[model samples]
Target: MRVVIALDSFKGSIGAAAACAALAQGWLAERPADEVLLRPMADGGEGTLDAVAAALPEARRMPVTVTGPAGRPVEASWLLLPDGTGVVELASTSGIELLAGELRPWDASTRGFGEAIAAALDGGARRLVLGIGSSASTDGGVGVLSALGLRFFGADGAPIPDGGRGLPEIVRTDAGSLRLPPSGGVTVLTDVRNPLLGPTGAAAVYGPQKGVRDVARAEAGLARVAEEAPQIDPSTPGAGAAGGTGFALLAWGARLVPGADEVAALVGLDASIAEASLVITGEGSFDPQSSAGKVPGFVREAAERAGIPAAIVAGRITGDADVSGFAAALSLSELAGSPAASLADPTRWLRAAGARLAAYRTQDE
Candidate 1:
């Protein structure tokens, strides 16, 4: 039997590579002769950089010091692929997890990620892959644009403050000092397809997740930016990704693509699924949200489309998750007794879950 394992990181508990390795070990323990392949997966979120770097061994990690989301100095890293493609993930520097305390929806910035992008450009990278997921800011990516030489001015022509709080004050902007990639173009990878403003857009749909209580303010801020720049299509799909980071990048001439689909293509997931007898995928949480562009959801869908058996191994499987695409599912939290323990040591439980799946067809039956 041939099996392919493609799993996203378990977040704080484990990375994509480690999770795939542990799962493979457990599956091999039960089916020693079965062919198993591991494919790391991400949706432009937390593990995007790690997944990309793991997939490409020749990628170099270039470090740059930049401002963190909370206005602190932090040394962050971006990937420089052997093909002169630079990979930048927003979660590394401006992610929500970096916030130690309360979420600063009004003050968080993507300035750090912007710095990384600038460094990659300075290093002569022509093609850029930007993973704009799991951001901490509701600033509509003004901070990022500012870092790239786009100047925002208020009614008095003064520089706008950082974060969403400054968006409303912006009356004008200019990109006179902007620099373009080496004509290879920039690709913005994201899972979200929400627009830049209104109810289903960036602020209303994602603000609450970032500890924001006033969705109206965030919406207004993004709207203000859109109003200032009529050329930016606020209603475009994916404009809401990364707290309107997609919108900002689009204004700067970046193309938005589905992160999981792009990553899967880059890693040859479609071919792997077709060649495998069983396809397995997973994530930290398999919930309603996972039904979208998340790894487990689309991976299972792809396997089903290819007429292959598909299963999922998630850290926690919510009861309401749409698991119709999967033939079976397993949860580390259930296998390890509790969510706390499962998270504290995901490797052991992930292996156990994998073995359990390996033995699912047998089980002394």
Candidate 2:
């Protein structure tokens, strides 16, 4: 029998690679003869670069220092796939976690992410995969465009400052200096499907979590950009991803793709699942939202199509979580007897969950 453990990062607990390893460790302890395969995975968020890098050892890391979300210089790296495809993760460069205790929802920028993309393009990558989850900005990706050589000039002809605070300044954009990845262009991975400017847009939907008191102000900032740049569709689904970073990339001729699906394809998920007797996948939490471009949903759909059993092991499962498609569902919170206990150490709980699931055989097998 063969088993495949592919899961998204457990967020604060551990990365996708470590989670898979822990699960594999427990499963193999029970059945040593079982050919266990571990595939670290992500849905285009914080661990995207690490996930892809772990899966493809052939990928080379391209490290560079760039401006961070808060206007400070920070070190960052992107991955160059063996096939000349570049993987750029916004969370790595401009994610909310970088700020730690100093949340700057109003002013954090995406400049660092764009710089990493530029580095990959300069290194001869023909196609680009841009991940825009876990942002710390509400600048409608103005700083990203600025880093990529698109200048924003105010009505007085001076360049605006580098954050949402500067967005209200009447502006004109110059994109002539922008260099695109060969003809392959860019595919942006977005975790959300919200529009660029609205009540449920970037600011209103995600600002408070990032520590903002004025969602309306952030929404207005993006609105100004929409007025100035009619070519950029403000109403497109996923335009609100990463505080309008998705909208910015779309304006630059990139296609918006669901992050989980995009990553699964990049990591050759189906090919691995094809030979697996059991498939295990999950994330920090399994809820109604997991059906929306999350790793678990992707795994269940793939496993069902391949006629294999798929199980979910997560930190917690909300009451509304739909698990009808999975063969088995395990929640660390329930196994550990409390949410705090599970959150405290999901890696251990995940191992126990894996061992329990190993007892069940794939229905199709």
Candidate 3:
């Protein structure tokens, strides 16, 4: 049997590439003679850079230091595509994972993300594609703008305090300080459709996730920023991703595109699906968001177009899931004793799940 192992990261447990590797190892144990293909996938969020790098052997890793989510120094990684394009995932330096519970949205910033972009520019990259998701802040890119030389002033013309809560105090913005590399073109990949302000805006939809309790306050602050800045079409898909990072990128003249399609095209995922007998794809969780141009949904569609059966193995499955295009949808917990136990021991569960999946093949065939 020919099997293609394509999976996303299990979030805090394992990376997409490592999950695929574990699955492959388990499958090999059960079906030593079968042909197996490994593919790591992402939804244009945290692991996008690694996913693209895995598929494209020509990509090179570039190391850089940037400010962390809390304004501390942190080392981050980005990929340099062969075409002189830099691939960066904002989460590497500004993701919620970097913060402890005590550090809430009001204290987070995207300054590190800006520094990463600056580093990419200094590294001779003329084109930059930033994957915006899983951000730790709701500053609507104020910190990033600040890092890029944009200055925000209060009513008295003094510099405003840092953080999303301070956005409402901005009286003026000086974009003259904003500088880019000589010829760098910027693109942003996102996975949400929230707008820049109002009910469906970034603050309203994602602020809570980042620890904003006073929704109205945060929304008002973002609205003020929007008034001073150019209007962004929040209706655009992925506009709401990364706590309005998409909107920020738009303000910075960065092209916003759907994450899945961009990553799929970059990794030649469609072609791989077409050539595979069975395609396996998954992520940490499968929900309505998965249908919003995420990796698994995209892979399932591609597999359908290729007349191939696609299976899914996820960390958790919730809310009456509907994986219509997939042949089978199994959670790692289903093979393990319990969901909580599987989450606690993902590697063991993943290996067992792989073995069970491989056992489905018929020897007579």
Best by lDDT: 1
Task: Give the whole-model CA lDDT for all candidates, comma-separated.
Answer: 0.87, 0.86, 0.79
Model 2: ten consecutive residues of lowest lDDT:
356-365
C-alpha TM-score for every candidate: 0.95, 0.96, 0.94
Candidates by lDDT, descending order: 1, 2, 3
Worst 10 residues of 1 by lDDT: 356-365
lDDT by residue for model 2 over 86-156, one digit each (tens)? 99999889998888869886678999988888888888889999999989988888888888888898889
Question: Which segments of candidate 2 are over 4 A away from where they belong?
Answer: 361-365
User: What's the lDDT for residue 202 in model 3?
Assistant: 82
lDDT of 2: 0.86
Residue 150 local lDDT, model 3? 87
Per-residue accuracy of model 3 over 1-365 as CA lDDT, tens digit each: 77888787888878888888888888889989888877788766778888888888999999988888887788898888998998888878888887865557786888898888877777878898888878998887887878888899998989886678788788888988797543667878777766777777788888987889998888777777667655666555555567767776777788887777788788877777776778888888888778667778878888888899888889887767787767777787767767788788888887877887777754324
- Deviation (Å) of 279 in candidate 1: 1.4
Best by TM-score: 2
Candidate 3: Cα lDDT at 137: 89
**Better candidate number, 1 or 3, judged by lDDT:** 1
Q: Which sequence of candidate numbers ranks them by TM-score, best first?
A: 2, 1, 3
